[model samples]
Target: MSKDEMADFLRRRRDALSPDQVPATVTHPPGRRARRTPGLRREEVAAAAGVSVSYYERLEQARAPRPSPQVLAALGTALRLTAAEREHLARLAGQVPLGTNAVREPVSADAHRLLDRLGPIPAYLVDERQDIVAWNGAAVVLIIDFGLLPAKERNAVRLALRLRDTLCSAPAGAQGEFIRQSAAQLRAAGARYPADRVLGELVNEFAAHSPDFAASWRDHDVRPLPMLRKHLRHPELGELELERQTLLLPGTDLQLVMYTPDPGSPSAAALARAETHSR
Candidate 1:
């Protein structure tokens, strides 16, 4: 990583930590001190990470230092680094080198066929940047006018949020939360592809357009969206509830997301009807 890039990462990581997180009890009045700055003080964080305050300050200042694995571990703990963030810090420090920035090769022909075969299940393929590279028929029915989204804005998370604002006239609430969670996973993938221009642009766009996106992005939140109930309103299907599943493609920064309706629910019955019509 370039020095500027490394510096940016360090600053982000530091700003994410809190005084209480580092075992520092706030002696001063609450609101005044708490609102002073976003993250823990350098000395407090350094003490928590078992490093000298000067050394930690130097690290944050982009001064090159060969940090021992032990020190890295302590810093990781002190900063509450997620697995991806910890790995990113290592990469930035030269302890590890994230390889080339390449858009992963397109899904295999067989994988494409398999995705097609999963019709009526609402499956779609997304690259690390969350671009909707492909999708099945059922996906079309479940998501509202996804094809209508501009190519630049076709990202699953982006679509979910923008569509909510445009059509529903209210924030997507739980759906928005779910998309933000997915964006965090995408951000983690970004650490591995720091030089990817497309990925970089997507991150920048979210940071610019969406406050929720910006907030979650800062938190360094990195976790795949676990199974969750999603409420979606489809013109044809009316209102539907579905369970979402996300599967990561091996050896690539691709993800396959599929939605299945709840058993014996109105949504399931509507899905069956839509599938028949689609055929």
Candidate 2:
């Protein structure tokens, strides 16, 4: 592994994180501590990773030739690296390749039709970049209005960032969790496709659009969908409790994300209202 590449990667990851993501900090959770530099201080990262400040500094400075497996693991945990990211780190550190494949999947026509048939079910398909390749009418109603957005902005990640202020309509905890998950999943994709310039561009775009995104991206919290429960509140629809599921199309990278309401639940009742409001 080239020391230069390693240094660049380490510095980029370090700069992306905020003080909250680092455990050794003077501030409280979800609260910002004013600092001259963005991301966790080097000493904070060193403390959290269980390494000496000098050692971590050398790694970032390319003075330390190579890090041991144990040190790598410690850094991964401290940085909240996703599986993909950890694997990428290992590869960069002269370890085995994890063989990630997530790009180049094409959406099928059958999948589009299937989404149409699932009436009142909020569903959409996202590629590796989390772009909204296909979304049903119900998805537009309950989840987001894909139709109203610029095609390029038809992305779940972008929606979460661009509409961050309004997204707090859901319980604060749930909203925070979803944002964290979206950031994690996107980072996972970045690890798998490290050379994808578009991913880097999107990351930059996110940084510009949302203040909270860059920090969450560093936390590396990966949660692939099919989440057990998701509760969201709309300006007009009131409250919604939806269970989300992901069905991956075999032999492809595209994923079908569909929401289902519990039988006799309030969300089930909200379906009719969602339909009316959407129309």
Q: Can you tell me which runs of candidate 1 are displaced by over 4 Å?
A: 2-39, 64-66, 144-154, 165-171
lDDT of each: 0.73, 0.72
Task: Report the lDDT tens digits of candidate 1 across residue range 1-279.
Answer: 445555666677777665565553422334534457778677666777778889988877777567777888898888788777787777666677675575557668877887888867888888877888878788887775467767787787778667774334223576657757766876777777777777777778777877888878776666556576777766667777887788887877778888888778787888888888988
Tens-digit lDDT track of model 2 for 181-210 = 667666666665667777778888876765
What lDDT does model 1 reach? Answer: 0.73
**Residue pairs whose backbone atoms clash in candidate 2:** none
Highest-scoring model, TM-score: 1
Candidate 2 clash figure, as a count: 0
lDDT for residue 56 in candidate 2, whole number 0-100: 93
Instruction: Tell me each candidate's RMSD, in Å, in order.
Output: 4.3, 7.4
